[model samples]
Target: MTDVTEEFRLNLAHIDGPLAIATLTGDLDLHTAPGLRTGALEWIGQGHHHLILDLRGVGFCDSSGLSALIGVWHSAKQAGGALELAAAPDRLTRMLTLTGLDSLLTVHPTAQDVLSTHRPTADA
Candidate 1:
């Protein structure tokens, strides 16, 4: 098997609005979760108030990955922002639902789904 470190990739980009997008591909287990966490912190530190983790390419996610996601969510909330998941594969979506995390994590069928629903306030 390939080294998990080499198997993961996280791409960062900014949308037209206040949203920052982190597109994740590959396995998200113990070996790869830290990258996700680090990317989230960097985005938050850069003053991004909204983030979307686009998981359309992710093939797997373990417990540690789930924990990292939750941590990022809390960090965003503490920063007065929000974190959302987009285009999650069916397996990952099922895992979220089975863990009862579906209620806590905002998930959309596509990044556009979140973008369409998330309108900036007049103040923003």
Candidate 2:
């Protein structure tokens, strides 16, 4: 079996108020998805509720990875937060669209775009 962690990398790029930006690189598949979910959930648990997943570095993502994205979205919502995707590759965008997840999750042109548009509420 291939060791997915060797090929995959997830880095928390930035954090501000309730928002966190995570950069995902390499392939996201069955083995790597769980780590992404766990790491994002841990951030949420630590009070960074709104998450922006920067997918610009991601080379590939399989069905399991898509499922993990949904899981993270659900978990974020349950925590009264939200999940957004940034700079998704065309293939991943098509997958999300085909799976009907595009309608459910917001997609941005870039992580900076998300950061520019986000307005932190006084309560947050």
Candidate 3:
């Protein structure tokens, strides 16, 4: 992969069943938030109500990113599903906690936790 690809800012991988993953790298800020919004909506439209965002690779995130996260959370809740974040950086975790969204959104320790701890919901 070239340096640009290696510097991946974001990626979304849709899985069967209810869960989909949004992997991010570089910085998740205002400039890149639109992409996140679009990708997340696509998965939601595809019947993936449950989402696990693997944010370990993300090096930075501002309020815009947090807005996107909240957007996903609300979208899932609206669709009768849940959106979880896996392995978020300390800063992101702190941000979510400070914003009081931590209690609203689910969080896991790792990507593996997404599968291992997943419980098939009745709604989605």
Best by TM-score: 2
Superposed by TM-score, candidate 1 places the C-alpha of residue 100 at a distance from the truth, in angstroms, of 1.2
RMSD of each: 2.2, 1.9, 4.2
Tens digit of per-residue lDDT, candidate 1, span 7-73 = 7999985554456888999899899999999989888877775888999989888888999999999
Compute the lDDT of residue 67 as modeled in candidate 1: 96
Better of 1 and 3 by lDDT: 1
Candidate 1, overall lDDT?
A: 0.84
Model 3 over residues 14-115: C-alpha lDDT tens digits? Answer: 475777777877777777777888888888888888888898888888888899889988988898778899999899999988888899876789878887
Q: For residues 7-56, what per-residue lDDT tens digits would candidate 2 score against the true structure?
A: 78899999887899999998898889999999999999998989999999
lDDT of 2 at 63: 89
Descending-TM-score candidate ranking: 2, 1, 3
Of candidate 3, the 10-residue stretch with the lowest lDDT total is: 1-10
Clashing pairs in 3: none
Candidate achieving the largest lDDT: 2
Better-scoring candidate (TM-score), 1 or 2 = 2
lDDT of 3: 0.80
